[model samples]
Target: MLNVLVTGGNGQLGCEIREVAPEFADKLRLFFVTRENLNLESESEIETFISANQIQAIVNTAAYTAVDLAEKEPEKARSSNVVIPKLLAKIANRHKIKMLHVSTDFAFDGKSGKPYKEDDLTSPISIYGKTKEEGEREVLKELPKAIILRTSWVYSKYGNNFLKTIRRLGKERPELKIIYDQIGTPTWARDLARVILKMIQTKDLSGFYHYSNEGIASWYDFAKEILDLSNLKTKILPIETSEYPTPATRPTYSVLNKKKIKQTLEIEIPHWKDSLKVCLSELD
Candidate 1:
């Protein structure tokens, strides 16, 4: 069996990957390690684990995902987003192991107001975005064959995510004011995990690719659907980005175009709302 090491073991993506690992048991042996245990800061630790386990492929889902806090704690973001990936790439390359690195759509400035493609110019506006973009570039520099997957608005039943926050707020608060101006697709962690598994199994596709649930939605639309599906009575108010000020400047539009990934994988992608319903059902 091919040894697959998954970083960010306790994260939503990592947990989701574990949920899907059983399906591929015949081909892969997955080892999921949390960031604390993995300790990307210690090169010796990483090297020891990879070498000892004879890890062939690494799925790096670990990242500094706190967009707002990243501004205040830029150094922390840099270490996790930039330093960790760079170190992983260097180690993975030396060991001749395939690496799959997860990135964010925040890499782009969203000035185009369209679904972003792999070749499009990146102009990150926030510290988090900047670090993640740099991480992607640095990882590719070390491992040219490494797969950099850019996904957006990720949520899942596990971990602290938008969907869970929405559900909780919907139950606690009578109303919510969500940003309607910024548009993007909400990607399910489970779907992304499955995609990663497919990529590992196929090994035919590589490089940068966008993966998110098909279709577009603003934060307001997303919240409305969440409440509507959950039978919550929360009144969702649609507001512009200016209505609610955030520490980090988000992309006005960061809907990722799935044409390349869908065509390459030759698999049908589920619509955002459909996936949302499924997730909500599972959550219930």
Candidate 2:
């Protein structure tokens, strides 16, 4: 059986993997480990764990995802986003194991008018984005066979994401204010997990790739869609980015160009709105 070690087992993507791993029970041996079991902060510990286990592949989903908080605590974010992944990449290279690393759309500055491609010049505005970009570079330099999948606006019922936040706020408040300037695709974590599994099954799939649901929507549009789908009696107010101040400066247009991944992997990607409905139904 092919042994696969998944880090960040409690995360949104990781939870989806846990649910789907049963299908590959006969051919794959999956081991899910949370931060407590395998601390990324301790490089020695991480090296020992990978060396001891006969792990054939690794899916790293652990990251310091707080964009705003990363501004204040850059060191903490660097450790989780950059340091840990670098260590893992080195170990994976030595073991000749396939490593899949998850990244964010924030790695781009959002200055480009069109969808950001895999080869686009990255100029991150926030600390979180900078650190994630650093992590990607380190991984590529260490493990050429590793796959870095960059996704945007990720949400799910299992984790704390934009969907859950809007749902909770819509229930508690009468009106919600969301930024209308920022445009991107809302990626369902489960769908992304499925894509990852499909990529693993395919032969010779590696390097940096972009993966997000099809169609683009601003934050306001997404909020309205969520409320409409959930049958909530909440009103959504569209506002500019200036209205609601945040520590981190988000990209105005972060939609990624996913043509490369789709063409290379020969996989069909679902539309953002369609996947949102499926996720909502699952939540219900």
Candidate 3:
């Protein structure tokens, strides 16, 4: 059976992948490794672990995702976001194992005024983006067969994401201010996990692909939809990105064009609002 190794097993996306792995059943042997078992920052540890397990395919969901905190901890971010993947790619190449690296839409500067295509030039605005972009390049360079999937605004019922944040804040506070100027698609971690599994099933799938829900919405609209679906009484106020200060600068429009991934993978994507409903339903 094909053995699959997934990193960041405890994270939002990683947990969803673990939950769905059983559905694949006898087709693949799945192993979920948390940070303690597979220290990403330690190349020797990762190499030792992979060599011992004889992992066939690596699904790298590990990343430094704390955007604000990344500004203060650039080295840690680089180690997790850049160095780890570079090491994995080298090891995967040596072992002839397939690698799938998860990336973000933050790789772009958001100056294009339209949805970013796969081949568009990347100009990262934050340290987190820079590190992630570096990870993508390093993986592709080391293992040409590796697949790099860039997603945006990932959330789920499981972890610390925007959906849960809004849910918690909506209940605790009477009003919330979300940015109206920023526009992007909200990708449910569950949905993305399913797509990644499908991609793995296809042996010919490789290269950079953008995976996000079909439609786009501003943060304000997204928050409002979340409130409406949850039947929350919180008032969501729209404000500019400037009104809300964060440690890292974010793209005003980081929507990704999914045409290449859709055609190449022969998969259908759900709309943003539809995914939001499905995710919210699980919270009940």
The top-ranked prediction according to lDDT is 1
lDDT of each: 0.93, 0.90, 0.91
RMSD of each: 0.9, 1.3, 1.2
> Candidate 1 vs candidate 2: which has greater lDDT?
1
Select the stronger candidate by lDDT from 1 and 3.
Answer: 1
- Residue 104 C-alpha lDDT in model 3: 99
lDDT of 3: 0.91
Backbone clashes for every candidate come to 0, 0, 0
Residue pairs clashing in model 3 are none
TM-score of each: 0.98, 0.96, 0.97
Q: Using TM-score, give the best candidate's number.
A: 1
Itemize residue pairs with steric clashes in candidate 2: none
lDDT tens digits by residue: candidate 3, 63-156 = 9999989999999999999998998899899888898999999999999999999899999999999999999999999999999999999998
Worst 10 residues of 1 by lDDT: 197-206
Count residue pairs with overlapping backbones in model 1. 0
Candidate 3 lDDT score at position 109: 95
Residue 197 of model 2, lDDT score: 72
List model 1 lDDT by residue over 1-284, tens digit each. 78999999999999999999999999989999996677888889999999899999988999999999999999999999999999999999999989999999999999997789999999999999999999999999999999999999999999999899999999999989999999999999999999998887676557999999989999999989999999999988999999899999999999998899998999899998999999889988
